[model samples]
Target: MTKSTQGFCFHTATSSHVEPLPNAKKAMAILRAAGMKKINFAGGEPFMNAEFLGQLVMYCKETLNLESVSVVTNGSKVTKRWLAKYGEYPDIMAISCDSFDETTNVKIGRGTGNHLKTVVELSQKCKEHGIMLKINTVVNRYNFHEDMNAAIEEIQPFRWKCFQVLIVPEENGSEHTLRDARRFLISDDEWRLFNEKHRHQECFVPEGNDVMASSYLLLDEYLRFLNKGWESRQKVF
Candidate 1:
């Protein structure tokens, strides 16, 4: 099989620990050298750095000549006007909506209730501005049964919906109890079952292998701006 594309995730340095800018840049350079295209920006919340994001998007379009640029975000901070402004610049958007229920959503999103509503509204707004909208749902033990159905039902009208099993990354100081990735993680068997039950529509396991050369450029730019050594950091896996 052909190798997967490389992509990078970006987050602000102000809060929420673990900086991956260095690694991301390195990956970007590798992808670019290999003549790769397409880039995706994901984060703790990308909208947190509005100015940086705008510059990054522009750089991807101009410097890398990338055909596809996407951002995955939690629709807590963005508005319809802000989306309208950037909608033309970026090619696609994937908004995270874990649960349709407000109470469960608050628990999963940590005080961000009404995220489903916000994301739905944002999706509609994106459609108006000629942007493709995708919904991302993290299925886990807590909301697996009902949440999956809810997500499929609500997001079917949209262009795409990505259902992913929960992956508790090795950051945020919960490593001790979260040692077993399989314990809290969903199995491939579970995914198969979910797929069979939701056969009426097409759902996909995101191919995180896609690499974009611009990601490396973004990483290099971010590191040069900060002037720090992040070469020895631990991997999230």
Candidate 2:
């Protein structure tokens, strides 16, 4: 119901691009001047270049006067200092976490150890800093059966966004993906069962394959809108 972004750029998995993207300030200014409402700072890990990320977040909220600013992060780089420095900027901080089991998480390539623990710590920091915490989980073959209600209850995120392991032919299924989609793909029945199990949670926000395919104003690493979903990307400049 609130005003939100039409496009954003972020990696669905751990990012390989260590260097920050080009013309970030100019991009923010352009989007703002174009009447864009919210600017979400995301990507191969926005915090990889924390200084630049902080600048964009501040600029969107302060200079651009955008309605909301948000970020999609892996939670490892979100720190107390980061939240303290730019806490007021982002209206939401979404952390990607897929599984609760250590072994399953490793298989899912989310991380090697205690991914949930780190997410929980970040949640606390967000709470302390007066920021809204959102938990994002991608349902895949590896984690579809694992019940996440306990972990969700523990983190107490303002929102829990559940997504199907999105298979984009030109993206996750392409050569650029961080992990193999073959190993992660799950059946519709499996996804349905998983949803039926946790859909009752107050924070639950479901995004299925049809909904995913319908439309999203997602910007690629180059700031181009991935207009045709995952199959192709388009340049706005």
The whole-model C-alpha lDDT of candidate 1 against the native structure comes to: 0.52
Report each candidate's C-alpha RMSD, comma-separated, in the order given.
8.2, 5.5
Query: What are the Cα lDDT values of the candidates?
Result: 0.52, 0.73
Q: In model 2, where do residues sit more than 4 Å from their true spots?
A: 1-22, 174-179, 227-232
* Cα TM-score per model: 0.66, 0.84
Clashes of 2: 1
Winning candidate number (lDDT): 2
Model 1 residue 102 CA deviation (Å) reads 2.1
State residue 172's C-alpha deviation in candidate 2, in Å. Answer: 2.4
Model 1 residue 209 distance off true place after TM-score fit, in angstroms: 13
List the lowest-lDDT window of 10 residues for candidate 1. 1-10
